[model samples]
Target: MVKKTIHEINARIRDGSVNVVTAEEMVNIVGELGPEGASREVDVVTTGTFGAMCSSGVWFNFGHSEPPIKMQKVWMNDVEAYTGVAAVDAYMGATQLSESQGMDYGGAHVIEDLLRGKSVDVHAISHGTDCYPRKVLDTSLSLDDMNQAIMINPRNAYQKYNAATNSSKQTIHTYMGSLLPRLGNVTYSGAGVLSPLSNDPEYLTIGTGTRIFLGGAQGYIVGQGTQHASAGMFGTLMVQGDLKKMSPDYIRAANFTGYGTSLYVGMGIPIPVLDERIAQATAVRDADITTSILDYSVPSRDRPVLRKVTYEELRSGHVELEGREVATSSLSSFKRARAIASELRDWISRGDFFVSMPVERLPGNTSSHAMKETEGVSFVSDIMSVSVVTIEKDASVYKAAKIIMETAFNHLPVVSKDNVLVGIVTAWDISKAVSQNKFDLVEDIMTRKVITARGDEQVAVVARRLDQHGVSALPVVNGGNHVVGIITSDDISKLFARRH
Candidate 1:
């Protein structure tokens, strides 16, 4: 058994004698030479992934202007940024929407624009202070003007992600892209065995302080990513890099039609083939990796898992689902992923880059649990009245008034013909209608912007909404915005009275 260390690999890299191969190439090399032989022949294996990571963002320190202001709220290119840290520092998340362009232009676009050497409009406002008295600052600058532009992403490079499919009748727009109705198609977003985490499934060489290729720039892994659990089939990495050194080709801005914006980051990790174990891991193929196909049509966090399918099946362009062949597609670019891995391999073979051992292995054999409410906690559905009285939008105001007179209820949910909640009509609106003698339609007198609650909402949140809106009642709706029940201030009072 030829046992080597990362130090040995670094020495080889420095002496221009290192032998490197990509994860895909390792599969073929292992097939020909076996694990032990491959480990002795190959010094390192490079892995890569190019996918939409919504958790990505950039932090900036704008050089202060004359009569500097303490920036409390900031916007770059009309997209809001968090300015809670310092007077001239702000962090803009990629998914944040633009005030003027909404989903069309967002923080991701601003980040890419800055990277592309374009000028960005910056506006900041602050409450006048004694030390920093200036209230507002508006200027245009490029990336070269910033003191620092660091990309500190909380989560990136998911080891494996569930494929998405919709079983509902209507198409749903999600981060997974538009899932066609009735599982018309499936969309996945991982690079299979070529992925960084997939090549180092045990977090052996890939950990905090691990040097990586990020957005065409040398970067480092900061720590374990959010929602990382070693016990599950999924894992993630938290990484950071200098945005100033990144390239537009490896880092791009993307906007899903209805899912706002996310950053497409190209990342690669070099794994030192220290022994047979490392070589065996790097030889993982698409057939060995498996993930579930989750129903994205379900609104809840615990979406229904349709079935387990291998990456090979997903890459084959279709998969069997409910006895039908569902077309499969990848949201992550395999072509870009292969290019990134090849780039990293070349960097290592040319002695320009070297792999490093992890400072400490990431947590392993740990399980994550779904959020569960404590005992005695109640949701709006627990106390809401199931027998809800609703009126159609096209109904007459006289009919609404008659319903209010006949029943003790003061509010009626105005719905469409398909029973979708559109508005709400209160007795006060009906009284105004009667006084004005304007009995045209229920929708004309109803409040179109109805304050509503979801069935899954906690009672405390619903109470706050009711108090904030100063509304006596709220129509409880489902995911489809169809009113299923009604919760009122009186009902909440009754629950507390009973508890007492």
Candidate 2:
């Protein structure tokens, strides 16, 4: 076994004097054990609260995705302990808000889209309810619904997300197969309305500890961006979250990083596949790290031993793992409605929140606002309108209504021959026009006093317009008052949310 105790390694970390080593060199160091004794040599790498500590004498000071410059030598024990504590901290400190309330879908599974970007987890059971082709379901879960929820139980880690396919299969196979026990009280199983994120290293670190690389300078999540990047030993592709971005090609080419080198990369096979290449370069065999758990299919990994769990081990079979205490003791369906309703009632009783998402970057070059303005040029003028669907002012409201039906836009500008903004039109307006259907002349029914802004206008003004009118969109007009582009409330809301 590695020499130092977790406490000793932790003390070194606390003192800012821990000796750190990377998987690159660690793998080399472990190679001495030969492929025969490899599994026994691999340390139980912990994260979140637990900091890094090697099974050997070396202090492995590290955590997942810490870039270089910020990364320094520390005992692996220290790093493991830190992560373990951090995870505990997150769980402990998370307020018993709506998320902590009651709702049990036996366990959860996270679905990720490795290429375009990460997709949010959708509960396995809820996935079906959400994508139900039957359409008999009354409602869909909102973000607030998800936010007020908690990760109440143990769950499976998933690979992909096909909303429709999963939805249908879940209802027919899993929910029906397993849920018959609950009887006819509108019961369903799998994951509930929300799919909580699975950050546990056991589920997330598919490439193993050394497989992930943290190149360049690593730092904290709140600030600090990743600097340089490359693949390393154990097929590791380093791209720390703190880094600005991770490059695929850089990871694709590199095999061996230096001893004790840090790596940060996206989480996926390319990472492990790369780590395998690096391991070959480093003369590290697969047995050097992989464990012979006998049956890799063993479930309920939080325990010390690996074994297949039977339903008989479960109390009530579908017991609400951890967060169930509150779900039963504290909340009733009436209580749930009241709790959320209380929020709405409080807002009603108190007042309203006038949130704004200006198109320009926040005051301090923050990425909060999706689109940023140049030094002088306005965001509106620079925006190139694409996939635009237009309708003439002379066209009947029915024609305008049809445009919105076939296309995605909810609003369009009423431009005259000179391309001047004669009036503003929207689906809501078209709906009103259709309802009224008073006249054939578009001008007679057109909204004459439209809320128009100059092309040079600030996105801040656009944000303000949305709030004042309680409207979903606005049109961008040129200096000659010609409609050049359009901005919608959705864009502003999404931009603002991303920036935050």
Candidate 3:
């Protein structure tokens, strides 16, 4: 378990508390609690319109690794997080996910770092979930032509958009996971509109309790045709000049690629939190492995849910809130991204485009909870150790190193015959033990008050503390202080860097 400060926080700070911050007592902390640098959830993707195309069927061709793309999750000035395409083709067609399988960057945006520009997020996307791996950086060429070239490709990007397509309330309820009585601010938007084509009452709008913040603004009621499964069906999202300039491939991809699977577009208003409002969604998710695995696991076997958010409250992050500046930029940004996509697709004809991103080390398995795949992985059960070390209090340095070299472990637990963990003997501790030379027992050189991880706690929280403490390994212990397993920095490094 991560031990709290033994001294007061102020005292710890005075004695070099690394990056600890004073507790917040200001106005309510806005935004969800994201990791240090990854708190900022607003991402504005402005696809430029480019007119270029390539012959069909050159699928899976990574044209180059140039102009790497990236997404930034801005949290605090110093404590923020980011991730980008470390290596092109490392995670084939599957969407690259960090330990956390939350959405940050999707398609072409994945290659942004190589093509870093003004509009690119000021920070990293927090997780290097590379999707459309672009070419590596080509300093010899300009990014303008390169980006345009990529957008012109007709390769269908894997999107999880689940927007409304039919006037059928069924589609709305399915995607929204709830019911909205009206569309937008208009009265009777969902169940009220009559479809001329179907000659039936169309729930063309969102049902109750389903509030999707797509445009930069919230509470928008999109027309039926706009939300169809077809690309550009949601109408053109306004964006920069370049994407609109490339039309054909953009449109073709949209026409072929299914509308994204998510309920809404705004980044800040993450859907998982809102989905909990559907009552027992979390519990239902937990009960089934498949349900737990799906980031957007829907069509659950539970009872129906309803959306109860108001335009004002959702936009402003308040309930029954009055006169607050609604942060609809998340929605607005999506609209712009969509518009740019449409225009870019309109500009290009059907062909393939090549975007490039750099090759960073693929993230290895790590103890950081953030690194755990949201669905498949959860709490780390036990870190596999090549060897373990158990030492007596009087074990000599030579004996310890000899033991270490034999077992392939750099650290050992020092215990008495009674098996009480009194201290730890480490490679670093051995260095000390040797210098002192007079030491006869492991305790002579060991560090006391051993740091550890609880078996039941999440990995990310424990891993962060291990990093903060500059410790190489932590003992996994039970409430009774019985050592069960050990986690080393090498384990984390191997997990994240994949260097093992």
Candidate 4:
């Protein structure tokens, strides 16, 4: 049994005698010396993770002008910021897109530009008040010009995150990244063995007021993150740091093709080895941590878990799913993560940084639950028409056109011989086929990548699918992929009309 205290660790750090090592190095040290011996020798273990954190933002106060206007609307580098707090203070979220540049530029870019010493155009509009009468303001400002610039992230440093793969035939662009069709690729985030929360799974040394390395600058943990679920193994942290002191190398901007923009944050946490338990926790390996592989193709609040795999398998550049080998990739940079941990380790060894015990431990055994809607709410099965008109993929285009004209339905679901949904055909597709004089099989003119809904899904989820894909209808299917019914926009409109 070995025991120490934060006071002893601080004294050693101040005297430049603290023995600090990165989490990656601690693994080997523990294997050689055991947890008790390692606890006696290692004073602190440094951990790091670098990846896209969407719930991040910067809040700044633009010093009042001579004709100070109470900014009601604000834009930095053409991106909007929330200005409901004060006269000139505004908070810019990382995912907000630019009005003119769209996804090419965003709030994350503005924050990175400010860190790089670039001047951004600042424009604001305000109602003329008695004291502050200026109605408009247009100026150029730098990070130094702001009275205070602070990065307040709502959530960061996920303990362990699920891997994502798509089972649909069409590729999907999401915040998780672009998932290839049919589980062609698997993408996971987090620095497996070097993640901050992974080293302190129980939040023993990392909690409120815990000092941390945030974006190459010192930061503090504020409180529990928004969606902290310890029981689910998806814990998070809320942190704040000085934006002016951050380095561009540690704070960068990124865009996910169709998923707007986000900020790539470099963060590190140092855990004090107060006992053998703490040392053992810090020495966790990738193979010891496991996460579920979730199907991202499902458009709902709850997605099906494909399987559970350890980080070792996920980092090997491939994973086995249902006997199929799928290529793997990492959105988080492990190289930068190692660099961050090494930098923190050097800072502690040189007496430039000291570890502190948390004021209060974080909550444990908590779980996140899905939002509950009103009882007896409508589902796709409630609003869908049971008499679904379908056509075989091998049916003639003339036959599909005849069915469409007779039923007055614009869309027809194309199914396989086993009565499973395979594709869909529209009136326009049949018209084009007839005009082009290519009245071939329905499979030739049908859309292979069909968007579908499940009978058990909520109506609102199905409605979002219809709007997201710009389609007018969806075929509701069963667990076996059998088309049970069809839901259309008209059915939703009628439901809304009756409810109101």
Most TM-score-accurate candidate: 4
Error of 1 at 290 (Å): 0.8
TM-scores, each model vs. reference: 0.80, 0.25, 0.28, 0.92
lDDT of 2 at 188: 16
Question: Tens-digit lDDT track for model 2 on 1-500?
Answer: 22333344334445544333222233454367542232233221111111011111111111222111222111110121111321111111111111321121101111001111333322111112222322111222222322221211111111111110111111212211211111211121111111101111122223212222111111111111111111111111111222223222211111111112111121211111112222222333213222111111111122122222221122122323223311111001222222222232222222221111112211122121234546443344444354455556787777777778988898777878777888877777777767776537566567766775555555665677578667776677766877777777667666566656
Candidate 1, poorest ten consecutive residues by summed lDDT: 366-375
lDDT of 4 by residue, 1-500 (tens): 99999999999999888999999999999999999999999999999999999999999999998788999999998999999998999999999999999999999999999999999999999987988799999999999999999999999999989899999888998888999999989999999999988898888999999999999999999978889998877899999999999999999999998789999999999999999999999999999999999999887667899999999999999999989899999999999999999999999999889898889888977787888767567889999998989999999999999999999578899999999999999999999999999889999999988888888888987888899899998988898888899999999999988888
The CA lDDT at 489 in model 2 is 68
TM-score between candidate 1 and the true structure: 0.80
* Collision count for each candidate, in order: 0, 66, 119, 0
| Off by more than 4 A, model 3 | 1-203, 206-410, 415-423, 438-444, 448-474, 485-500
- The whole-model lDDT of each prediction reads 0.92, 0.30, 0.31, 0.93
Q: C-alpha displacement of 137 in model 4, angstroms?
A: 1.4
Give stretches of model 4 more than 4 Å off.
374-377, 391-402, 414-424, 433-450, 467-470, 479-482, 496-500
- For residues 1-500, what per-residue lDDT tens digits would candidate 1 score against the true structure? 87998889999999989999899999999999999999999999999999999999999999787787999999999999999898899999999999999999998999999999999999989897888899988999899999999999999998899999999766878999999998999999999979888888898898999999999999999988888877895778899999999999999999897788999999999999999998999999999999999998766678899999999999999999999899999999999999999999999988888788889788767666787757597889899999989999999999999999998789999999999999999999999999998989998889998888888877877886689679999999998999999999999999888888
Tens-digit lDDT string for candidate 3 (303-408):
2222333322332332221232212111122233334333322222121211111122111121212233454332435453524457777667678878877877
Candidate 2 — which residues are off by over 4 angstroms? 1-378, 382-387, 437-439
Residue 126, model 1, lDDT: 89
- RMSD per model, one decimal: 6.2, 27.4, 23.3, 2.5
TM-score of 4: 0.92
Number of residue pairs clashing in candidate 1, backbone atoms closer than 3 angstroms, sequence gap of 3 or more or interchain = 0
